[model samples]
Target chain A: MEPRSSGLVVLVLVCPLAAAVLLQLFGRLDRRLCMPTALAACLASLSLTGVLAGNVARGMPWVYHPGNWGGLGIELKMDLLALLFCLLIAGLASLVLVYSYRFIPHELAPRETSYYTVFLFLVSGLLGLSIAGDLLTFWIFMEVMALSAYVLIAIIDVPHAFESSLRYLFMGALSSLAILLGVVLLYGAAGTLNMAGVLGVVRAGANGQATLALALCSVGFCVKGAQVPVHFWLPGAHSAAVTPISAMHSGLVAKLGFYGFARFIFFVFGTTAAVGVLKMTSVLQWIGALSILYGGIMAILEDDLKLMLAYSTISHIGFMLLGISLLSPAGLTGALFHLLDDGLAKACLFLCAGIFIYRDGTRSIQQLKGIALRTPLTAAAFTLAAFSLVGIPPTSGFVAKWYLVLGTLQARRPFFAAVMIIGAMLAAVYAFRVVFYMFFAPERSGALQMDDVPPAMLAPAAILGAGTWVLGIAAIWILPHIQRFVASLVS
Target chain B: MSQALSYFNLTVAFTVFIAGVYMVATEHNLLRKLMGINLCGAGVLLLAILTGFVRRGQQLADGTVAGTNTVVPAMQWLAVAGIVAITAITAVGLALARSHKRVFGTMDLDEKRNGVKQAPPQSTPNATEDRR
Candidate 1:
């Protein structure tokens, strides 16, 4: 089917870019306009994405070419996958920006303008990446995202923040180089930078160059996604950023790496014939499994609340990767669903952590004893989000985990299914430990007298916390569309 | 011999890339690591430039000169943009390292050797207290 040509796709990126530029220009004069402008841009993008999603669901994917450069122009294709990612990025960004209204004033009072500007830039880059139809465009947007993230991570100017941000920058630069090399190699092999053209070349036959490109790209993305061996930068970087930034990094930025990987594996590399020759799937599967166990164990051992949540992000990433590596329709469905579920749950938890820090200035789990009594709403939200992460029944996490297990069984990899179960149990141990500290443990002597945070901050966390359950209950209506998309991808 | 000479730039690119990777992996000093990252970026940009040449040669062999000029300029533009990005990252890295030195009084990343006083994790209570 010929994709319906539309110009509205560009507006999704334009909204954020315009807002960022506006903020950079006049935001200093009146800081009060900053939050409203940023929030408006995000909501505009989210609603635009919702409209496009509706169109895409009606069997008409929108494709836009920005310039008149014929084959050389960049293509922005809004298919089901792209729309799903756009929805997640814009939707979560709207919430995080709302949370930032109250959060940023406390954290970076003088630098609110720069913060919002950079934050909007980051959102634009992520949205651009989701819809990027060619390799070079994807790389460019990836850099935009990475650079903004590096700035946001170090924006606080604390020594540890700078150190961790520097580490992340170096690693990110290396990964970008690796990815660029892969793109160059791919261009050499396929003679085109367009993803559709590359798919055609790969389906004809896999060459050594193509396989090497795949390896380089996969390695780059793995580093970005915080797979086991190269995951050292993640904990420091995620924990060092301000709360909303931390939420964005853990909840959205890291998942873009997985999105890039999925696009390449399913779209560019085609299917088992090419990937099987390299035995890439099983290698990735093993790596994902190792990451799951390592991240889970480390999370359980961490005493710092944010650090524990950061580690759990790694474990959840492993689950998504494992789902993708299974290379089944069911697995892809589970992975995509988990991406949404985990993004909401993790962001909600981070926001809750922010509230705790705002109240008592402590992220130490042991120091947070009986925090529930003071900030009852945040505690309740944290528990619900934690339950989702642990894959308890009637939560969104359970639905995604169920599909992943079913996927493993269908692929005849019962051992991986067992691994998934173990990973969930590990998740339970860490998630529930935080809940236990917040509720059951006795209050410390110096505990601060504080109530729930302002409604601005509390609302985002509460909405996301409730979103996880709502998504779970609504999965019956959602999963079919996801399955159909997954089927289209594999076939 | 002629083929090897013709592909000399590719060889140099790979060599530079490997050297950069080595320095980045082993160097403890922040400045050296930044240099290494720049080198790695330069190598990749060089490789990208070489791709244009390789493509042009293939096109010439196929008796297609219409797109030859276009390919070279496009690659050159890509290289230029890459250089700008590398410079931006270098600037950010340098600024970060400078502040890091001001805060901790050393540019060495090795905690034990430099006896660098590590700041408590930013999210911790003590750090927030310090800020307050």
Candidate 2:
């Protein structure tokens, strides 16, 4: 299908790009201008993505080819899958930027301008990744996102943060090299970098080179996604970064790996013959199951609240991977739905954790005794996010997991379904443990009396907390559209 | 002869890539690991350029096959971009190492050797005063 020519795609990318460059140039003029500039860029991109989503849903996917070089020029295609993730990236980014308004001033005051600049660059990278139409474009944006993320993770300047960021950088660079190798191999085998062009070649007949490329790319994405065995870098990196950065990492950055997998699995190597030969889906399913179990168990044992959430992120990523690996319509829909739902809930949880740190200056769950009594709204938001994470009913997590279970049944994978349920149970154990500390634990004598966090910080968490419920209640209307999306994807 | 040369290039690329991976996986020094990362990237870039080499022979502007194979200039452009990316990563990694050394007083990654303990959580000013 020829994509409709639309500038909306370019506008979506240019908003953040322009803002990042502008901020780097003028940001030092006044630190106060940085946050608003970043926030405005984020909101502008969000609105543009919203418009692009509307066009895609109503008509065909939008494509923008810069320089009109045809196959040689880079392609930026915004399909249903791309738009879905774009919405999530832009929406969560706006909230995180708002949260950063207060958090940055308090934590890393002097470096605020640079923080906003890098943060906008990060947003641009992610948004670019979403709309990237070819493997080379995807890899370039992947590097952009990874580089900015390393900087953000280390921005705190603490010893632990630096160490963790270094470790993450090493692992990230290794993964990126592997991915580049895969892209080169794929280009050699397929003679093209455009995803559709490669798909045509792959469908005709895949070769050993294509298989090797697939394996390399999958391994690279797995490392980035934090699937178990390669997941060690996550807990440290996620916990050590400043709170808003942690939220972005947990909420959006890690999901990019899964996004890469979905694009390749469903869009390029999607043929039944290719899938059977690769046996990739089943292997991925088992890995997802292991990650689910491992992350959940480790989260339960973690004492640091941020680390616990980080572990839970690994578990949740497993759930989405399992859904995608099912390769069924319901399964894909569930995975995409979980992607949005988890991003919102997890970002909210991290933002709420930021509030605790801002107020109490402690990350240990034990140190959070009776915090709910002091900051009831943030606590309530925390509980709401936890419920969503635990897949409690009336929250979006349940709806996403429901489709996933249905998908497992559809795929006749009863064992994986059981794994999903067990993962949820483990999630509940850790999530409620934190909640139990906050709401029910005995108060420490002479605890400082503090009001709820300033509205700038609290509102972002509250909005995302409410977003979880809104998504859940709206899933009734949303699921049909997702099913349509899945149908389009599979067919 | 050119075919043999391309095969040799492929062999060297894989060898350097594996050697780099080994260095990154086994090296204890932070700088060595960064070097290993660069080596691995260079190997991949070499392989990337190798891909654009016309295996049969060069196609001249007149579309006749030539005696010598020509490298597509596009791959060179890609290699240049890869170099820039690697340079940026190296700069960041070096800065990180410099700071890590300043903070922990060592270049070693070993936690015990560096004696780097996790920083205690920052205590709130009001809470600490209340406790006092």
- Please write out the lDDT profile of model 2 over residues A1-491, one tens digit for every residue: 45798878988988988999998889888889998888899899989888777667754789998777553436899998888899999899999998898889999886888899899989999999889888777878888889999999988868899889999999999999888888777776776777887888777775766887788888898999999989989999999999999999999999977898899887766646346667988889998999999999999999999999999999999999999988888888889999999999999999999999999899999998888778888998999999999999899999999889888988999999999999999999999999998888876544545456789998999999999999999999878777887887777
TM-scores of all candidate predictions against the true structure: 0.93, 0.93
Local error of candidate 2 at residue A64 (angstroms): 0.5
Q: After superposition, which runs of candidate 1 have C-alpha atoms over 4 Å from their true positions? A: A442-450, B1-10, B54-74, B116-132
Docking class of 1: acceptable
C-alpha RMSD between model 2 and the true structure: 4.8
Q: Tell me how far the alpha carbon of residue B58 in candidate 1 is from the true structure, in angstroms, after superposition.
A: 7.0
Cα-based lDDT for every prediction? 0.86, 0.86
Share of real contacts kept by model 2?
0.55
Residues A16-115 of candidate 1 have per-residue lDDT tens digits of 9899999988988898999999989999999998878876866578988888444453688888888888998999999999999988999988778889
List of chain B TM-scores, one per candidate: 0.67, 0.69
